[model samples]
Target: LAKTTQPISMDSYEGQEVNITCSHNNIATNDYITWYQQFPSQGPRFIIQGYKTKVTNEVASLFIPADRKSSTLSLPRVSLSDTAVYYCLVGDGTPSSNTGKLIFGQGTTLQVKP
Candidate 1:
C-alpha cells in the first residue's frame, strides 16, 4: 500500500487559508490522491480527489504536482467549524487496487481557532 507523510498537527484561525501537504514518494501511476476530513466523532467526509494537476470543489482544492509524489489540500477561508482531522489517501480507488478495499493513512489534526 502507498503511504503519505503529513504534519501531526496544525493551527489556524478563522478566515484563514490553510494548506496541508502530504508526501507519497512511492505512489503508483494508477494511484490517485484523495483528501478526507473527519470530525471528532463522525466518519471522514470526502473533500477532494485528483489524479494530476488541480481539482477544486466548493469545500477544498487538491493540487498534485507533475511527479505525483506529493499533494496539497487547500482550504480557503477556513472557519472554526473547519477544525478536524484531515487525511491524505493514495490509492487507485478501484476494487482491483487493494483487492476490494482502500487503505487510509493516519491523519493530520488541524485546530481552527477564533
Candidate 2:
C-alpha cells in the first residue's frame, strides 16, 4: 500500500472552484486511486476514481498525471453544503481482489464559507 499526503485544510467561498491534491509517491502499478468525501458523523462518500489520466463525473473531476505520483480532485462551484473532509485512497478496488477493506488518512478539511 502507498501512503498519501494532503493539506491539513482549505477554505473557499460559495460558487468558487476548489482543487484538493494528494500525493502518493510510492504507488504500485496495480493500484487504483480513489477519492471520497465525508461529512460530520457520516460515512465516506465515493466521489471519483481513476488509475491514469483524467476522469470526471457529475460532481467532480479527477486529474492524474503521467507519473501517477499525485492526483487532484476538482470541485466546481462549491457551496456551503460541500464543506467536508476529503480523502485520497490508493489500492486495488477490483472485485476480484476481494479485500473489502479500505485505509484512510487524516484528510484535507475543506471549509466552504458563504
Backbone clashes in each candidate structure, one number apiece?
0, 0
RMSD of each: 1.6, 1.8
Q: Give the worst 10-residue stretch by lDDT in candidate 2.
A: 93-102
In Å, residue 95's CA in model 2 sits off its true spot by 10
- lDDT, candidate 1, residue 88? 95
Indicate the TM-score of model 1: 0.93
Give per-residue CA lDDT, model 2, range 1-114, as digits (tens): 789999999999999999999999998787899999999999999999999999999999999999999999999999999999999999885566777456799999999999
Q: Write the per-residue lDDT of candidate 1 for residues 7-112, one digit (tens) a residue.
A: 9999999999999999999987788888999998899999999999999999998899999999999999999999999999988755455663467778899999
Candidates in order have lDDT scores of 0.90, 0.94
